[model samples]
Target: MVEIRTERLLLRPASMDDVPAFHNILSDAAAMQFWSTPPHQDEAETRDWVAAMMAISPGGGEDFVIEQDGRVIGKLGLFQFPEIGFILHRDAWGRGYAREALTPVLDRAFSVHGLACVEADVDPRNAASLRLLHGAGFEETGRASRTWNIGGVWSDSVYLTLRNGQRDVG
Candidate 1:
C-alpha cells in the first residue's frame, strides 16, 4: 500500500512486484560496494526480503519503496531507533531522492512517533552513505572498532543519532 507522496515520488510498502527494479539496485556493484553482502542477482532473494518485510514490518522499520516516474529506484525509510536507511540505484543518485524519501519519514519519526532520537550506523568506508546521512541531518556521534558483522567478518562501525524538534547534525 502506498503510504505517502512527495512532489515527485511515492513512498509505499514494497511488493513482490518491486523485486526486479529492486534487484537492479541490489546488483549494482557501485551501489552495493559497502553492503555487508554482495547484491542479489536473483529475484528470489529480493522476494524473500520483501516477504520478511511483509511478515513483520522489518523489525521496527517502516520500509518504503522510493518510486519516481513510475519506476522503483530504491528502498528507503526508518528502521529501529528511528534511524534512517536508504539505498538508491546508482543511476538515481544525486537527484535528491534520498531527501525526498527521508524527510517525511524523519518527520514521522520525531513528530508522530515521539522518538527520543534517531541515528544511522555506516561503515567507515561508505563515504556516500556518510555524506547522504549527514546531508539528511544526521551527525557522527562516534566511531567504534570491531562493532558489526558483515559478510561473516567483524568490522568497525560509525554511530550517529538525532533528537526531537527536527534538530539534526548536518
Candidate 2:
C-alpha cells in the first residue's frame, strides 16, 4: 500500500475510514453519470467496494484514494493492471486536481510496474474526462457503441492509451 502526495493532494490506499467520504462521491448522481454503474444506493455498498479494494492481491493493482485538504475527494489508480480508472467528487471538478493526481500514478505505472502501456475506457459523453486523459498524454484508440448498460441506460465507450515511452505504440 503505497501512499502518494502532491502539492495539494494525497493518494493513498482505501480503508474503511474512507467509506463515508467516498460514498459521498459515489452516491452523487451527477458525479456518477459516466461511471460503470449507477450511484451507490447506500453506505453498505460503498463499504463493500472499499473492502474489495483493500483485498486486491499485491502487484495485482493499486486503488489510491484521492484526498485534498485532509478530506477525501475521490479515487484514482489502476484496479486492473494497464487499465486506469478514476473518479472525483463533483465539487472537486474543474480545479486541476485530477491532472495533478494523475502525473505520478502514470509514472509509477510505467516505471515501477514496467508496463508497456496504460489504457483508459471513457464514456464519449464525458468531455471533461476525455480532456483530462488527453492532456495527460493519452490518445484515442477506438470507440464502440452500447458498450455499457448501467441501470437500464446504455452508454458507449472511447478507448485511449498512453504508452510508456510517451509515443504511439501502434
Candidate 3:
C-alpha cells in the first residue's frame, strides 16, 4: 500500500512511526532556514505533520519521504498543482543524493500522476536546491516575489518548472 522505490532510495508515505526522525529533521533550524516555520518541539506534533502529509490526496497533493538503508535523509513529493518540494538534511548535501532521490519522485509525478508538468519553487538564495532542481530537468521560469510566508514574514522564491509528456509554453 506504500513505498515507492527508486534506484537508491526507498520512498514511502510518512507515518506516525517516523516521528522521531522526522522531528529531528523538522526541528533543525539550520536545515530549515528558509522554511515556513520554526523547529518543531514536540514529539506528538510530528505525527500530526505526517498525518497532514498523508492527507494530501494523489488527486490533488501527494508526498513521500526519501529514505536509504532504512533511514530518512530527505523528503520530496507533489503538493497539488503538480508542484514538487524537496528538503534534504544538511548532512546529506554534496553527495548527489538529491539527484538520485528525485528520479522516482519525478517518475511518479509525471508517469503515475499523469501531470503535464511539475513545478519547484526555491529561495533564490538556496543554491543547492536550485542546482538540484536544474539537474532534475527543471527550467527556471521566473522569480515570484512575496511567494511564501515564512514565520510571518513574506519571502521570495525562484519558480522552476518541469514539463512532462506534452506541454506548450506558448
RMSD of 2: 2.5
Indicate which candidate wins on lDDT.
Answer: 2
Better of 1 and 3 by lDDT: 3
Give candidate 3's error at residue 99 in angstroms. 1.1
> What is candidate 3's lDDT per residue for 47-159, written digit by digit as tens?
78877887886588777887888888878877565778777777877887777767776776777777888988788888888877877678888997898887787889888
- Estimate TM-scores for all models: 0.87, 0.96, 0.87
Model 2 error, position 81 (Å): 0.5
- Model 2 lDDT per residue over 28-131, tens place: 99999999999999999999999988897768887789999899999989888888899999989999998888998898888898889989999999999899
Model 2 C-alpha lDDT versus the unseen true structure? 0.90
Question: RMSD, each candidate, Å?
Answer: 2.5, 2.5, 3.5
Residue pairs clashing, model 3: 61-80
lDDT, each prediction:
0.76, 0.90, 0.77
Clashing pairs in 1: none
TM-score of 1: 0.87
| Candidate 3: C-alpha lDDT | 0.77
